[model samples]
Target: MASPSSLLSQEQIQCICLDIFTSPISTPCGHNFCMACIGGYWDSSDVCQCPLCKETFYRRPDLCINRTLKEISEQFKTRLSLFEEQYAQPGQVPCDICTGSKLRAVKSCLVCLASYCQTHLEPHQRVGTMKTHKLIEPVSNLEDRLCKKHQRVLELFCREDQTFVCVLCNETDHRTHNTVPAERECTEMKVSFL
Candidate 1:
């Protein structure tokens, strides 16, 4: 059986509007959503229904803030705020794996799709397989660093398109384009100006 902690991740995604979950509530159908999200959804619709399950309620359900879920969500939100607080500083990234008050991320692992502070990053540095994962300076929105089409890390720079490319992109769409590792492209561009 999956733990509640594991299930909470899915619940958070279901409750949030724009990836921000606040004020969780449950409908009669046992579907959970944010109070604001469901309220706004129903206020604009003719029938009150579960957005996810599509179970219709002819009358508005007497929705109250789900106490247990609200508490759990609050704790999660608190920790999340701590995680984001570090990233608010200039040139810093938040450690996505942090549990409590998080420190500034020192590096981002492309394979992990996560940023880590120096302490949290110890495993990647010590583990052989993890060491093979590309570690770059901490950057936010690590998903954006992936090639949208290939869903691979954008490691190569396509000089023709002036955009980042994944390995598959180099094999397919960017096969004819002049390509180099982004680091090498940066160095070459710097030398050209000097």
Candidate 2:
């Protein structure tokens, strides 16, 4: 069984190489990797190891193109570019360190430099199809950025406390926080603020 930390969900992996040319290719481990990405990762290894699972195997595997994935990548890239243009701020957008695409300020972390797209987001927990990547919603709030008490980036929001705090907060101070759905939080907050 693959542990949460060991496996990268397919959706998250697909998001990473949305800008790259991706075709489905299987490794000897019976796992799929974006053809171009795996080709580069394989260039130096004697046996290709699954990047996510670390399962190693011999022999050249099949190169199969998943047309659906390729199409999704193309459409995602187009949408991302349009989103960037629509939300451009004066002189702030920079190419993300991981994906090398212009950051659209979708998510940010004070501890982790600045902004990242869905591609470069880090997974806090691996769920089903989409790994819930940990990220800051607005990506920029200089004042209440890092937790004042814990000095950690506020990742998850506590519905009970009506506050944003790091995971550590859940383990400690806000352990008993009666968290509600995020949509509930948004709906309530929106109405209150308006």
Q: Which is the leading candidate under TM-score?
A: 1
Q: Please provide TM-scores, in order, for all candidate models, with all chains considered together.
A: 0.52, 0.36
Pick by lDDT: which candidate is best?
1
**True lDDT of residue 50, candidate 1:** 90
Residue 163, candidate 2: Cα error in Å is: 52
Lowest summed lDDT across 10 adjacent residues in model 2 is found at: 1-10
Candidate 1: pairs in clash: none
Q: How close is candidate 2 to the true structure, as a TM-score?
A: 0.36
Local distance difference test, each candidate = 0.81, 0.59
lDDT by residue (111-158, candidate 1, tens digit) is 999999887899998999998888988889899999899899999999
lDDT of 2 by residue, 1-194 (tens): 12222333335435225434467665566565678788777787887677877886666565677676677556555655565463436665442544433555556545554665544454422444333433456444544666788887666679777787777777898888876544466778899999
